[model samples]
Target: METYRGEPAFNLKGLAAMAATLLIWTGFLLSLRSGSQSVLTTTDLALMRFGLPALLFMPLLLLRWPRIRRIRLRHALLLMLGGLPFFYLIALGSHYAPAAHAGALVPGTAPLFVTGLAVVVFGEPLPRQRLVGLGVIVAGVGVLLGSGLVDLASGYWRGHLAFLGASLLWACYTVALRILGIGALEATALLCAGSLAGLLLLLAGGQVDSNLATAGWPLLWPYLLTQGLGAGIVGGFTYGVAIGALGAEKTAALGSITPALAAVAALFLLGEPLSAGGLAGVLTITLGVLLASGLRWPRREVQPAPAREPD
Candidate 1:
């Protein structure tokens, strides 16, 4: 496998990891949208989102505590961006907007946010292809948010803004993952543990109430599987693997397809139909992602004729 800085690059394993992350992220959006419609509060959903993974990874986190403690506070906070704060915004957005909007605005705009961060914060040069791709993505996002901007009473605009915020938070997390050079599993453990601790503190302080006890098993089980296990554990780890293998820009760019998948899934499963604007936004964002990811037809590497018998 080709590698950069000890991390795999453009390899099959990373691609597989990204594929898994896509499915899990799609399910995560759907589940969050469903949870919004349920009796569960955003806090309730957040608890489940972080709880199971924290429990499952507690031992691992304990073992790594000494090393984890040495990480700088700012860096640690950045790594935790994918945790509660991110989930809260997503949950809030899901309450107001259909799953399609969340799907479109969050993952779809990630490449723009990530690339901008790279250029501004990391001082990386923006290639012409990536710059053009980002412009396309911005146009797509404008489509998604255009209707919301005019419909203030509907409150969909609030959700759109929250989704954009969540995307930015996720971008921070993605970049931090590359910067910290931590293993995916270890980072997942830390995020879950820290998020759960914060949730528990919130519960203790009466800042948020829990519905886990009253929500009943049927509704809660699906969330436990999708949010707790799938997103909290599986999604986090696979996303990290993707970043490590594909680099942050490529991972986020490829993830742009997530909006379409989630939007379609939401249509079938949740009966959330996409408007014309949503459809246009999804397609434009996807095309831009292909460009931003630099995907191309695989060419057979031509080998030069063997050296002419030392002539």
Candidate 2:
């Protein structure tokens, strides 16, 4: 086992990764908020959700076209199926739920799901400390929601369910990444391909369209820029890199901070008030994450082996 340590460089990279993840999510929230302000055509929403992913990934596909072509059809289908529900849920659920609530809940439960899946599917050991950590994090999220921390009372239960469903889909995606032997670059490319397929499905189902005139170029710009570039392209690439370097467990552990960060962003950007319950929840979640990452306690001391007599 690779024991965890406070390596300054790795820590710095972890922080950067967290920041990038937070920024990506923040951008998504901002775009979603903006999109909701007006009448959104299906095309506009699809473009906002997938345009950047497609554009950013195009060059990667071109560069590795032969390799991309060589990917097995079944594996490609699996990736597409895994990615579709996640994107669809977010797009639909945001219409009914508060962005802050969705933000807090999605990332908050993801680590727990990942941990559980690891144990069940991979036969990974469930350390007691990690379990405690997961409990603490869940308690924090409960406090955050139960106390109207993000005004979650305004959302319907159905919307919350949708977000949970989305999280599960995402968990499946993460696990698939591990099982499928998909590297960071290839995973990213596959994600883009999957997203495109989903978008096409949405279109086929009459859930979206491609006419830019209905959405208007002006109103569509922010969604395209933020969702496409900030969230889809840059965010996906950064997260893929983080997962590659840190492994899924630690990467997901580090991601536990995203909800708290989203809460902070909501306070500043969306003028959402920071309540006492919210603060407590943030603390609880943070502590939980520290515990889950095996960082709360002091490192074990390694005693040197006794000096041996000359052989």
Candidate 3:
């Protein structure tokens, strides 16, 4: 990977990606609130669970129309397969677990999974400092888990496990992006394509059906629009841009921010109380991510690499 010159700037794309991430974080909270409220019906939940992803990604299918002849079947299959478990696990887990717990657990563990995958699959080196940072992050997560906000015996364990499964699946997808060299747009498009396909299969199997009539446009539309636009389109694009700019490892490292952002959104929007332990864990994780990324306070001098010998 090529390193860009100077400090990383908050450019338009970067800003957009961050904004999209924030929106997605907010959307998760909103969805949870909506689920709690009588505002959402079973059908509305169904739409959120599946319909939104399909609608959000519908635009990407058009890319196959003109310039692009045919998407590589193998790549598309990989992306589709990688996304399936994540979508299902998250959708199921959110129903059982608190949004705050889900947010804290899922994104927090993602970077670690990515780091492990990089070492195992890509043979990428992990420096000692980065390993220590990873340890700190793990410790922070342990604190969050031990906070007693979630009940271990009351089926919440299943939800937490689901979120962990989804995190691992997402990590695999992240690694696939690097190994297959899929660009942001292409990867996003393929994920949408795969999601759409999986959703269709589920519907065909009589697992899910269109219930717009019972769902009503009032509740259904907002949920779908928010999830489809915010998480589906914008989230995909911003993440892609970030991946393009920062590479998979660094972009994945930035994922630690998602939980913090979600926590902040919950605090104000949902009036959720934050525990002292949670706050400390969040701060510790943030610091750990910065350290793992090798981002120092002041800019450091770059040492020149040894000259290569002629073959």
Candidate 4:
């Protein structure tokens, strides 16, 4: 790809892609919170997250099936580890923690994890701007959740830990997508297909579909659309493009906006009140994302050679 002197096409594309990912992710948390209150179970949500997308992307998988099959088991496992299991962990974690914890911890931890992994795995520079931005983002999350943390029960910590694990897995996913040179569409299709197998196994093991059974389809349909398509399919592919375009650190750092945006959404739509701390958190996170992403100080991106096909 050709480059401009200050702003480049890739940077612009990455920002657009990252923004879309943030929007979908914020909606995802909102959907999960709504489902927690409604009849949607983890299994129900998991199936939606994987099932429809699997069908939607089936053609891509079919066309690429022969090459996909040739992927080494470890590589396949790494790819699979990114999508379904990451979502499942967050869903499971919510059983113990409040929205504050999930919203704050999971995304807040992801940038740092991504940065660390990028350093160790890809040997990317640990830029000072990134460090400062990560610190600010962490502080923002603290503001967002500090009060909520005081009243946590024993089990909540488990959920907190799970959120941390989810963050780690997400970082791994981002790095793998970039280093492995997987195309956004290709990764989304393969991961969604793999997710289907996991969900089917759970179904075979007697997972209850009580939500789908008892709740009328009307209540669940909207969520299914959002979870199935927005967060499940589009979110993965867009994030992949971002990692490839923006590099892992900046892309992951941009994710800090998710909690702030989610909080803003809850405030307006759900009538949730934000404390002073929450307001500060929203501001801090926004500024942190700006600093981390270098949106203001845009740089020319060095384009990589064409992505190599997995043998």
Candidate 5:
């Protein structure tokens, strides 16, 4: 066990949890990209993303219903930023861009967006290092968008924009979490339940397409495991555990490699080749995330000598 401030910093359990989180996050991008390649629609992917988690969390939602009902509509809407709308953008992005772009743009740039949100919404002061990190992130994103522009016919820029939108929405969700004053599990349940309702409404109105029936079990089971169980349930739980054990700054720093991992995995697993520009973007964004997160090793405190002259 590593200690910080006389308490456990990074223990085996926390490290294991962080590892699980990284795997799930990588799997999430791959799964969404795979679904986009298949007959499944964004609506179908959205269903998989929340359906099982919502079902499993139903009882918990009911238990917390009284408190939940008291929440303001504004906060409720903010919380939903992480739900259907976010997923819809991400799924739409997958249709146009390779998983590598998403790997670079979504999670890679989330901290930048979150920092912007914090400064804007909460009036927090931006530190110089994080400011520089944000600038670097912008440069990296420019490279990514420029890469997409090389083949305008592919319409990859549209996907890149959607991924950025998803990142912003996720940032909003992160800000909302601070003000919402709810446990992680409760928030997850609330968002999933609400998103599930919206999904049903959208389905009923024919606002989105669905291919769950046509896709069959071959497509559906993997999604259920990756989207619902792995990303939705396990990832969130493990992230919370990691945060508790390693603290948020270190956990975020460790998690920043998700884009690089996803990009490499997609190269082999999904047969998506990373262009030089995309590779540069991923590496740059990874460095930016580390800087933006202000990750630093804990320094031992030096104790001052007692007043010997008084004796």
Candidate 6:
């Protein structure tokens, strides 16, 4: 067994957080999927998701405000591509496809996209297994979308493409996260502040409020909880803990279950039916996730540094 400052390496709390991250992601998909069905626009969902949570993170931004000038404006704009852009695009896509599709498309293809980018941009090697996984994923996405292609002129394909775009944004976000090496809270603070700015801009133009008024409070309140509290705050913190404990690769690999989980949730929560192709697509993509994940469970029992009682 591993040790951390002579204590057992098993951190049950961190493990719990990892599981929470998985559940939160699954729920996030469901919430957005369900919420988009309401009168709310993609812009409305984005505002509630980030804007409502702005206060929780805004204080952190103020505390770090003095050092804000040290960061580049260009980098901040790139971060927006990851946060609000990613969220609204998927929310917009969800309006067209079911949560099941968002679950299948977004997380399913993101790593493959990242792997391809890494190979091209950073000279990273594409091992045989990862290459095969990528092929399987391509096939899976084809089968998933294959039936729908016949109706492309009707614009259903646009939603699927939007989800794909969202995945690419996420791949970029993962890349950005690595380059920045910032804390979980710091990244969340920046993303929230940035998204809030965009939301405010839209609000000033009167593009977001009328829809919210018509959507009504009953429908809007739950979305507020799921996007703002659930995904925005809880998902961020738990994923950070999971990454700290399980290593980024393994934790991300474990995210393979998200789509399947989301599919099940959509069935029960939204009564969304899965066609035969959709079912097959889900399994195929899951297989692809396993192959593409580059899974390496840490075997060496290295001693992690002792956990500290904060001063």
Best by lDDT: 1
Across 1-311, the per-residue lDDT of candidate 3 in tens digits comes to 31222224334554457557656755754575555455454334544544555555557657544433354555445456555567667766776766666776777788899888777755678888878877777777667555444566667787788788878887777666655454566666667665666666876798765555655676666666666666666666677676665556666676766666676677777776667877877787787777666654445689999999999
Candidate 3 structure lDDT: 0.65
Give the least accurate 10-residue stretch of model 3, judged by summed lDDT.
1-10
Root-mean-square deviation (CA) per prediction = 3.2, 5.2, 6.9, 8.8, 5.4, 8.3
lDDT scores in order: 0.84, 0.68, 0.65, 0.77, 0.76, 0.71
Q: Give a tens-digit lDDT track for model 2, residues 47-103.
A: 656666776677777787776677666656655644556766766666676666676
User: How many angstroms is residue 304 displaced in model 4 relative to the true structure, after the best TM-score fit?
Assistant: 30
- For residues 150-240, what per-residue lDDT tens digits would candidate 5 score against the true structure? 6778889888889989988876665565566566788788888899899999999988778888877876899889999997878766866
Checking candidate 4 for backbone clashes, the offending pairs are: none
TM-score per prediction, in order, is 0.92, 0.82, 0.79, 0.87, 0.85, 0.81
lDDT of 4 at 64: 79
Q: Write the per-residue lDDT of candidate 1 for residues 1-311, one digit (tens) a residue.
A: 11123234456778899999999999999998988888988888888888888999999999988888887788899888888899889998898988878877888888888888787777777789988887887777677555665698998988988999999999988888888757898999999999999999999999988887888888888988899999989998999888887888889888988888887798799997777887887788888887788755457799998877754
Best by TM-score: 1
Cα lDDT of model 6 by residue, 227-253, tens digit: 888888888767656555544433444
| Count of clashes, each model | 0, 0, 0, 0, 0, 0
Between prediction 5 and prediction 6, the one with superior TM-score is 5
Worst 10 residues of 1 by lDDT: 1-10
Best-to-worst ranking by lDDT: 1, 4, 5, 6, 2, 3
Give candidate 2 misplaced runs (Cα > 4 Å). 1-15, 41-43, 69-78, 147-155, 209-211, 216-218, 295-311
The 10-residue segment of model 6 with minimum total lDDT is 1-10
